[model samples]
Target: MDCGKRHGTKYFTVSSAENFKECMETCAAIVPCHSVDYQARTKKCYLGSHHNNPLIIASSFDSAHSVGCAGACGGGGCCKDARKDDVQEPAPLPDTSCGNAGFEFAFFPNDITYLGPNDGNFNPVVMKRTQPYYKGTTTRIGVTDAHIIYGQTPQNWEFVAVNHRGYLYAHQDGEYSFTAPIADNLSLLWLGPNAYSGYTRANANLEAAYTPVDSAPLEYKATLVKGKYYPIRFSWDNSGGAGYYELKIKAPDGTTIVDGTTTVSPYLVKFGCREAYGARQYAPWGEEN
Candidate 1:
């Protein structure tokens, strides 16, 4: 069979077709087929795995044309930058007096064995925390002033799982380092400018041990812009053992944003889209309705 158009990688072949539309349909049925070049003279079709490929003049067909089958596929045309539409540009950094770096913590009982990864347990707690059986928000994520009973059972069997969500405000633009209290099971993640998406969730594990320092802390590094709230989420599980945790932030200026010994309070504000009449409506920051 003649390879029409002679563009893109060809991994499959459709033997026969009555017309161009039928040939195009066959290409659509294949998962990896991104585009197709049809030869009307011989009623033959060539499937390609790529959208952008140099055109080649094939003598076997009187006329050759290509069409993109994949969604957003350029179909032998110039490929457009898809990221421009998929990701939102960073908004102007707010004033320095915008807010502080803190997170809201919701605690749940892990009575049953947690079978999956640490993050897998996070969503369930977040969605069910307000439910009747859920234990509810026990405390803030910062350093605890006193011993807090996160969760407990009558039989002395205790288990506590906490999910923390909030923004980390930067005073100035520069590289920043973060560290959290080392625990038996802890997952800490920071989503900044380079990797912040409303639909994307951060899930980085930070349970590394420090050799010299006894207070081994989970650490992460990210370059942040001043007056911006970088979304962050952290999940910790004591697994029925001693539950003690703290959050610490070190700015680019070498100043400690939140010391391990002090308590950091959440902003007590919410932002983003809200559900209204089966549609999402943009709600201004700190605007509650």
Candidate 2:
């Protein structure tokens, strides 16, 4: 995306962007990119702050183009740079802590277990169901995140592949431990950028399975920043009858900040559309915001 006029020099650009979402990820790195414009056919992604569609001056149109915001800018929100050349105000910030709650849960039918790309069970046909064709949100994902991102959960719980997406706000900066002591069939947990971007069962930091004894239960330790939040993806599947997916995280102080027994620790939070309707809107991005 062109820095979208003004701003003097180009702030960000991706030579070979895989998709518009990649542009969002890039713009978000340097600034709070609230809007985006993408062309699938040309693999072109335009990052802007404009109310996007309504305010932007001009841009090429393509049927494959997708224009929307990631959080507040969704549902026909702007995808253009809304910054003024003279004003030079800072971008909006996300919540500091406890503003949003609960992890967004999604369940994929017919696939009860997760198989990484390298796993023997991994194949094209099994991955087809996880494509998310039904979505207006997720299309090429393998059982992923959010409430509206995947719509509604199936009524029946048994024999379904589950995906949990959210952010884990690190209360303190230090080494933190993650584990899934109670997981049925199979489960995978990912932290940091991979948790939001390209995530899969095989690359999970922590994997727990009833059958695959080789999969480790604990991720030892991962360093986090003080008051900073990292994207967390926890995915699991239940074969039949009864199943449970419990995520447990330990803070630097040795206290179980995220207790599986309690179900949800205040540290677990989900952002986006749900926030706008709440009393306080927390920052969906890192604490630095």
Candidate 3:
């Protein structure tokens, strides 16, 4: 009720001070009303504003509020309830045919190290002081029907043609095939014992018992460790072999750890570090190269 403050004749009447106080108390009890003030000149009481707000009280329980205030104050169940409404679960995986989603291995950039014999790898080797070789390129050597026995043995035999009394001789053979593919932009040297080395008479025979072939797609398994690098090793199967077998690998990231290749079958091309990736695609039996 507005008791016209501009008019001197305007008046407000109450039964008693207690009654007036009760009315003032009731208005004061309202949330935004602070207190009752009695005007000195007009003798009229005015209700003032207050600090009470209910909306702020409601927001105190929100998840965003809890997250924002982290350790400041222990928030109430508002955060928990909000979380219940906002929470979600991950989606199901896709149906895959090839084992491990057509992935047989993960060849990380730095997980390949190729070592070799005589022509050495990773370090220099002193072969008889006069014949010193550091490391050779990715070249392959093979032979066919040199009469070799295929089985598990401490030392498997590899074929190489040799010169006998006056004719050409062969050693360590079965129908052997080697595949050594050349990497683009990378220099590789294919060394062979010029057929003349096998037979006393040289007749423009332009082949070696050990000839090179295209290499297979290298496969590896790796895990990322501390320094944004992957620690890994090569993994493959070599069930049947006449003598010796080897594996060669290359990293896509310009870091070549393998100098020449390994002569050991089912070779473990172990290495130290590599970079990280979100998803990896590995080689599979009939996979498109």
Candidate 4:
């Protein structure tokens, strides 16, 4: 077997009929086989059946002299450059009127999970899944303002919202506000600490409504016990077809507490001592909380 294309992949140059067939089969087995170059003058095979081909004697070839001229120098035939240029670098970004820092508080596990290779510069905190508040269908993530970024429900992972200008904007709602600056795009995420305690529903005017929107028509009220151990309880004045409500809670330290769908009843309670610890663990959907 003769290897063709130095620094190039392997290719077969068949000298006989049987060898040509073998070479063709061998090349086919390879993942990416280069094209076969057959020498009509020599009647030799390369990557295919070259047997029974008419052999050309020096007398039969008009280009024989030119071919001979090249061989005379002992350099064989002309060689082509095989090296490729390096990959191009990305263009520099334009200077932004916005600074490099920003902040936002939101539900954990936002759209972009992996920070590419910029985790260090971004200082992303990991968000965990936890229990849902109700039993059958009322499941949601809650974001609370009281929890610290590094506390038990710490906001180690950060994300921010952006305005039409593509700069970061603070998530502003009545009674729910945090201080964080804007940079380029809002690539940070702020997850809710507890499903019930994190975010509160609002009226049309954005007034604080303790119950979630889904709980509205159903008349569900979720009560939270705030102290050393915070436990959120839930009950429905009117029951919807939904059998349960799902609740998820995050501690200041990024620990997650989740209650999957549970039966609507007198109360649904989750305990947390410092908003840093004692949050419920996340659970899968349809499972008992």
For TM-score, the strongest prediction is 2
List the lowest-lDDT window of 10 residues for candidate 2. Answer: 56-65
Residue 76 lDDT (model 3): 36
Reference-based TM-score of each model: 0.44, 0.48, 0.17, 0.15
Report lDDT (CA) for all predictions.
Answer: 0.44, 0.49, 0.22, 0.24
Better of 2 and 4 by TM-score: 2
For residues 3-53, write the lDDT of model 2, one tens digit per residue. 222221122453445654465555566454444545545666555454332
Order of candidate numbers by lDDT, starting with the best: 2, 1, 4, 3
Alpha-carbon deviation at 144 in model 4, angstroms: 24
Q: What C-alpha RMSD separates each model from the true structure?
A: 15.3, 15.0, 30.3, 25.1
Model 1 spans > 4 angstroms off = 1-102, 112-157, 193-202, 205-215, 264-289
lDDT of 3 by residue, 213-251 (tens): 354422332221211212121111111223222223333
Candidate 4 local lDDT, 64-155, one digit each (tens):
11111223323432211111221122112211222211111222322333232322222222121322222222222222321322122322
Clashing pairs in 1: none
lDDT of 3: 0.22
lDDT of 3 at 35: 34
lDDT at residue 215 of model 3 (Cα atoms): 44
TM-score of 4: 0.15
Candidate 1 RMSD to the correct structure: 15.3
